[model samples]
Target chain A: MLKKDPNFTRLKKLGGRGYLGRVSYWLGVDHLLVVEVTNYNERYRRFYFRDLQAVIVQRNRNRMWGNIVAGVIAILPALGALALLSDGEYAGASLVGGILVLIGIFILSNTLRGPMCSVHLRTAVQTQKLANIDRWRRAEFLIETLTPLIQSLQVSAGEAQSPNPATVSNPPAASAVQPDFS
Target chain B: MSTASNNVLNCPNCGKSLSDLPEMLPAVERCPACERQTRVVVFPAFSRPVVKGATAEAVMMEGEATCFYHAKKRAQVPCDECGRFLCAVCDLEVNGRHLCPQCLETGAKKGKVQSLERGRFRWDQVISTLLVLPLISCGFLLPLTSLAALVLVVWKWKSPPSLVHNTRLSLIVCGVLALIEFIGGCAFWWFMLFGSRRY
Candidate 1:
């Protein structure tokens, strides 16, 4: 069994929920931990800050498609409400307008949530897509938070660096790794 | 060199190459071919070469400890799991333990090492689904499905469990559900065959 690291803090606003599973992020001193849980079983992936190559956030048209579908389906109730209002049936109009309002709320929330995005992390050997982090805002937060930590660790570890030494992002406080069992 | 790194970070949606854009780190650009917006953040390791592991030194003394795998190679550390002496080349450090190749593989198979575990079958989900699906889809098949669920749950009760929450409660629920379905199915069948009918 994988023991939970007390030192590893769960990243704020870094969790994904889906019908199948959930993906959550935990930050260790030197590495980032991604835990994926499905049907009560968990899988873990660790990416050391020093080994990370890049993080790419790609914006997609999922919101537009969602809006289009919802709008098409909502047209009937909207027309019904308008027709009822024209016929002077205030109660019927209000009842029909309620459905349109619910649909409007859904569309408004989708827009408020902003555009959809997909985030992928690249390493020397592998590039893994973050299944849960599909928002540009969350992706930006990851980049802003991670870029500095990775730069500092690589520089401190004496790994090859192309970035300037003085401007390396200040790493989050480092915690001591657990003692060896051997 | 820059193009090589950009090649792998292609458009996730349309599978088009975004490398044609100007050379800049931490920049957002729209893929010309796919017209999708993409944000790229490159770290320092993006341009660095892969660091190689240290090689084992040859035995210089007549009585020097040797690697468990390689007899002539000098031993530098012992494996955390197996306690076998390992040379620098043979020592595989993961999470913090200095494990030999064999112990690492064994740990991976036995699920002792967290890094290597990729997936696990949730028996509770399996048993629960088996017990519920038949009742919802085909009520007549409940007896057979419930019997199967009961047998499998009892059989796998002592096996390796799910990682997070204790599945004992779920198992009990599954067992009870399965038992109820089985008894109901049997009673219905008995009534059909033996009970009086008002026709």
Candidate 2:
């Protein structure tokens, strides 16, 4: 077993659905940005913080019509049972209505679930989706955390390429002397 | 190059030696020589040299088991697959099973173990076959088989995908075909009953 690093602090945990999604949360990050995706099998990818260009979140809209149709189908049996109850079939009406109610509840729970989103972490080399973040809220949070960190790293890298402040300060003295000439 | 061989830590920004700095992993520590901040992440495994156990000695003594691969080397463990005596170097541990090179190669070639596989059977293919085969054969049980195929696709929708990537194209095709079959079957039954009453 690989030992956990004490220095590593989990900023946030993005919950995903299914077994592969559950397994991704437990994988160790060893000094590299690891994006793991699991469906039937697990796939792992690593990225350097310096190489990360962007983190994107794309929202996926749920189809309301599909849910509505499913709900209608589920309630049809109960509607039929109500008509039978009016004709004095109490026992049959109660059993059929009870079953349809349970099925309707199941369909309603699925319909009421929040929208899912895809999270993509892009580099110059390749763009990869982080499968563990399925919900839109979690994808937004991850983007918020990573975008700044990458930007800061890029800022530092940019600063390194420019001339040092100590060496460039003497050249600016010439600009200050132009004010005296004016 | 010599400093790298000696494992001397250096500042990435200024290329200044940071051997004297206090060891702190995953933390920004200021380099004393360069006055620059450097983020260091150290893995403990890299700090020490790996120790390999001594190789099996020669089988000079009587009744001592010898390695099948190397006759001069004494056997430490038997191969789990073929029961061949193996030296420490020849023993390969895979999924807790001690296998020789021959068995490992054969197992990989035959696809007996799923460990090396990257792809899997697609459920969509199964559904597609179930829906289309009955229709192609003009079987009387086409309606029932198509219904079963649709039920399977719906039931396994949220199930973990197989090794193959699932586009759900097959599921849609199967569903459409199944729905058509169901509608035709229902219409046929209605016509038979109502038309016969008219006759």
Candidate 3:
């Protein structure tokens, strides 16, 4: 878990450029400083996993609020009918009352459709966030675990940076040493 | 790392990766892949891990509804009409009142619950009025049948009043039609009885 990540500070400072900027750029913004920050990029794209997770979480939280609002809108027609019916005492009360009840049920069914759709969308986004996080975590683990090996390679290659013909004379000893592992 | 894979070249101006490292940095000490005394920037990756079910916390965070009448714990039963959260004891049965106990009581007191007090007028009343109105205008010696239908329609239409005002107009038209029927019937009867006397 301990990492000497230089870009961590940069990522934290830059934040996950919100969806607005990304969308604006995609919509052909002329002044867009377009940069390809793929999830494959270990620096700039680090926050994407968390951003996706936040989106899913936010959507799920909105579900209950949306459901309550939809439930309220469903019954508005019944209120309207009652107001209209209050005009006459009873000569048409039974008929209007029956119609209002039926209309209320219909409206309730209609309102439920919206929350149901949102619930489905939220569930889908939640699943996508979980999957993306899992992929990013695995890739990050591999890249971090290999950091020492990569640094050692860098050191050896740095010594060989100068391509001198004199240093190239030892090609035979390097080739013969590979057969002595046993 | 030496085969161009480990290190990345960072632009001096913006610190972003410069793919054309040799072109951007002329005095580059090491190859683009190696970070030895090179202008290549090695930026490390940072990850913040979140558990899969983290969003479930948000689901729990949404506020719960409170009962309208009891105002005790959370309420789940939304009123079909007003959308108010009403407890079992508070729920009203009327079509639109769908109220808490307090509102239900108020509605009952105001007689808004059974909006039916204004007498439901049927089409049959107008039909009956039309059938019987003629008897009243013709001065029919016998006033049992048609006269009764007209009287019932008028009284019902007039007393409680119809929810639809058209029912009153319908009764008036029917009454006129019934009167014509009654006058025609009496005139025929008088003609037959007097024609025999003239013969």
For every candidate, C-alpha RMSD to the true structure in Å: 8.0, 19.1, 33.2
lDDT of 3 by residue, B1-199 (tens): 1111222334322344434532223233333332222222121111111112211111122465666655555564677656788555555555434556666666555546533221223554546644645446644442344455556656666443332124566667766665666566667677777966987
Query: Which of 1 and 3 is the better model by lDDT?
Result: 1
Candidate 1 on B27-139: residue-level lDDT in tens?
44666578767677766566544445688999999999999899999999999888999999999999889999988998999888866777666788889889878878888
Per-residue CA lDDT of model 1 for A45-78, tens digit only, reads 8888978877777788888999999999899988
Candidate 1 chain B, which ten residues in sequence have the lowest lDDT sum? B1-10
Off by over 4 Å in 1: A1-12, A19-21, A27-30, A37-43, A75-99, A144-156, A159-182, B1-23, B27-36, B60-63, B164-166, B195-199
Candidate 2: count the clashes.
1
TM-scores for all candidates: the values are 0.74, 0.35, 0.22
Fraction of true contacts retained by every candidate, in order, equals 0.45, 0.00, 0.00
Q: How accurate is candidate 1 locally (lDDT)?
A: 0.75
What are the runs in model 2 whose C-alpha is more than 4 Å off?
Answer: A1-3, A7-13, A19-41, A63-66, A72-75, A87-113, A161-182, B1-199
Identify the candidate with maximal lDDT.
1
Q: What is the lDDT of candidate 2?
A: 0.54
User: How does model 3 score on DockQ?
Assistant: 0.01
Q: Quick one: ranking by DockQ, best first?
A: 1, 2, 3
Best by DockQ: 1
Model 3 regions lying over 4 Å from their true place: A1-182, B1-145, B159-165
The alpha-carbon deviation from the true structure for residue B105 of candidate 3, after best TM-score superposition, in angstroms, is 12
